[model samples]
Target: MTAAAALIEAARALDALGFMPSKSGNLSVRTGRGYLITPAALPYAETTAADLVEVDLGGAVLAGHRRPSSEWRMHAAIYAARPEAGAVVHTHSPCATALACARQGLPPFHYMIAVGGGGDIRCSGYATFGTEALAEACVAALEGRRAALLANHGAVAIGRTLAGARTLAMEVENLARQYLALRAAGLAPVLLDEAELAAVFEQFDGYGRLG
Candidate 1:
């Protein structure tokens, strides 16, 4: 499917996952010439391909009738910093964002957490929305991971495809939920050792996985 089609599918999928409530999320996919993104303030369930806004790498709107998402600056910054990032997904999923708001990183308590590209998912310090500070914080937080949580805000996931980004978003939230549950049970989560994390990183490289 085309990148535009993939972007629409991602929005619907996030809506189904209850992650895009009240237009609380944004989705974008890189195109041959630029990127296509969901417009600002549109409910994901009701969004259409026509509702997408096309923008250049520098965040200049080139097509569509509506404004791009307020978080477009963050997305553009990510694209500029990470050329391997073909799609970006930002969402306000409850568990993940809750941990973020607590200024906590996703601890490496589960092997699945390695799916985030190595160790724990990083959390960026809080910043006002649509600001350059927010973009810079996100870029720094995502330096070595496929996903990063914005403190007191939401989460962002980057991938080689829109599907991959969506998958990482879901996984981050799932791991956060597990962490919460385990903590409530008075169990100290067992974190992966440095050797184990190194092995996972090496495997990822050997397999040519781009997440």
Candidate 2:
């Protein structure tokens, strides 16, 4: 699929999964000139490829009739900070947002936490939505990690492709759900240590690849 089509597809799919309640999330993909992002205030169900907006890193709208996502700055920041991030997925996914609302980061309570490119997923410091402060905070928390939780807001995931980023976003929600379940059951799950996590990372280096 074309980049714009893939972006809309991912957005609608995530929206259907309740990852973006009331159109509270955004998705973007890097482009030669800048990036293409979901338009603001539009439900994913009604969003079409034509609704996607292209904006440069300097935040100028280059194409499309609609305004880029209010959080476009956040996506730009991630693209600037991580050269390998070809796409970004930001969502107010329930379980993950619940933890972020508590100002809690996802600890390495499960080995799958390595999917985020770290031993744990950090929760960014609280900042007002749609502001550069929130963008800066998100970028800082994402350093050395592929995903991060926005304090009292949501979570963001980056990847080399839109599908990869979307899947990582889903995994973030899954991990959060599992962690919360353990906490709710009054079970303090054992977190993997650094060495153990490193091994998992090595194992993941070739995971899902055909030999």
Q: Pick the candidate with the highest lDDT.
A: 2
Candidate 1's displacement at residue 66, Å, is 0.4
**Cα RMSD for candidates in order:** 1.5, 1.7
Off by over 4 Å in 2: 208-211
**TM-score of each prediction:** 0.94, 0.97
Candidate 2 per-residue C-alpha lDDT over 49-90 given as tens digits, one digit per residue, 9 for 90 to 100: 899999999899999999999999999899999999999999
lDDT of 1 by residue, 1-211 (tens): 8777778888888878878778888989887767888999888767788889999878788989999999888988889899999999999888888889899988788877787876889999889988889999999999988899999988999998888898889988999899989988999998999998888778777776544
Please report, in order, the local distance difference test score of every candidate based on alpha carbons: 0.87, 0.93
**Highest-scoring model, TM-score:** 2
* Native-to-model Cα distance after best TM-score fit, residue 39 in candidate 2, in Å: 0.4
